[model samples]
Target: MQNDLVSIITPSYNSEKFIAKTIESIINQTCENWEMIIVDDCSPDNSNEIIENYMQKEKRIKLIKLKKNSGPAIARNMAIEQAKGRFIAFLDADDIWLPEKLEKQLLFMKENDLSFTYSAYRLIDEEDNDLGVFIPPVLADYSSLLKTNFIGCLTAIYDTNKIGKMYMPNILKRQDYGLWLKILKQIKSTKGITEPLAIYRIRKNSVSSNKLKAAMYQWKIYREVEKLNIFQSMYYFMNYAYYGLKKY
Candidate 1:
């Protein structure tokens, strides 16, 4: 494995069907200075077998299996703890990266000297079929990120030099958003690559489809956790509505 590599942390659970493609995407990256760290949150399916098989052939791929079934937040934290990269990138096991995803984002980060960054992503179905692309409305600064969690986890890459660790709440959902909020607390600006560099697989029976549940978690993160006022909550609520309607 390359030292000081760009570590790609992937949190997986029951991802047997899609893990291979996700690993392949990492393998196919045009930028080769990366190591993929796959953390299995005690998947009940054949995900471990799939990952182990691939690891046998690809030395750059590393697998770590948790003893219990923690949520994505804890799983991701485990991967991040084991990461040894100058820059840390995240990729969910079901999502995929474009060929030039790392190359483009790395150059953008280096040129701008930005600590954290994300990119536009294409929405895909459970079968890995593409839906229409969903580009970010605009690049976000600290204030704008308060309104919405517009940055997809798969499209996010951060400089470890500035923000060494990404700490996530061990909640059921919205962990990614919570981590972004935590990241922004330390850094003022978060950049975005306008081009789509990844595919976000919208699972058929995913929790993200539950608007009420998602809103509840967001409210908890914003109000009880972050201590946002009612007005801020309403603003974020409306933003969620806009994104939900547009995405659906």
Candidate 2:
């Protein structure tokens, strides 16, 4: 396993407002040996142009433009297939990571011999102002994660050398949650680092901002994706609702 090479998968669509900062965060990482695979899902805006500009200067940054507008799941899957690093990390196009994020998290994983790991993250508004709220990390297994998705997509990293490359479900929303569940099923537990390492930008009009739509997808995940029984679905749904409300 080439422990030094970290492959970052980012799915971008119409993220021109925040994509440059996201790329700069990766470029400024304390750990130098990393490849960032950004898959553009046919954005109407010039998000791809910004990525192309970065690709010209940084050889580590690669951009894949999809002929059609596939969703984030498929875009991320495309990058995963092209990843050659020993460790796979996820960073959304609109989120920003700390300079030491990769360095510290990689050290934590190697020290603990962990295959899957996630860290805490801070919330940011559209204007890039810190909301002064943070999501603390927690150790998660398949059973516990069935109740709530504690691992933030921007802060999660899994080692392909240990668990192999796992892909997200084809579903639109909650695919990262599905990937975590899949990895947890194979490994015993996912370790948590409590320090906030990334900024998750929350847009007012984003799909995640719509509570009704997000709830529907969560239900679909439990019922269709996981195939949990109605009673089990309700049991987890209650916990999800409680935690979802409490997160803010």
Task: Tell me the tens digit of each residue's lDDT in model 1 across 135-186.
Answer: 7755676566667678999998887877777677777888888778888778
Candidate 2 clash pair list: none
Candidate 2: tens digits of C-alpha lDDT, residues 80-140: 9999999999999999999999999999998999999999898888998888656555678
Each prediction's number of clashing residue pairs = 0, 0
TM-score of each: 0.94, 0.97
Could you give the C-alpha RMSD of every candidate to the true structure, in order shown?
Answer: 1.8, 1.2
CA lDDT, candidate 1, residue 54: 90
TM-score of model number 2:
0.97
- List of clashing residue pairs for candidate 1: none
Off by over 4 Å in 1: 1-4
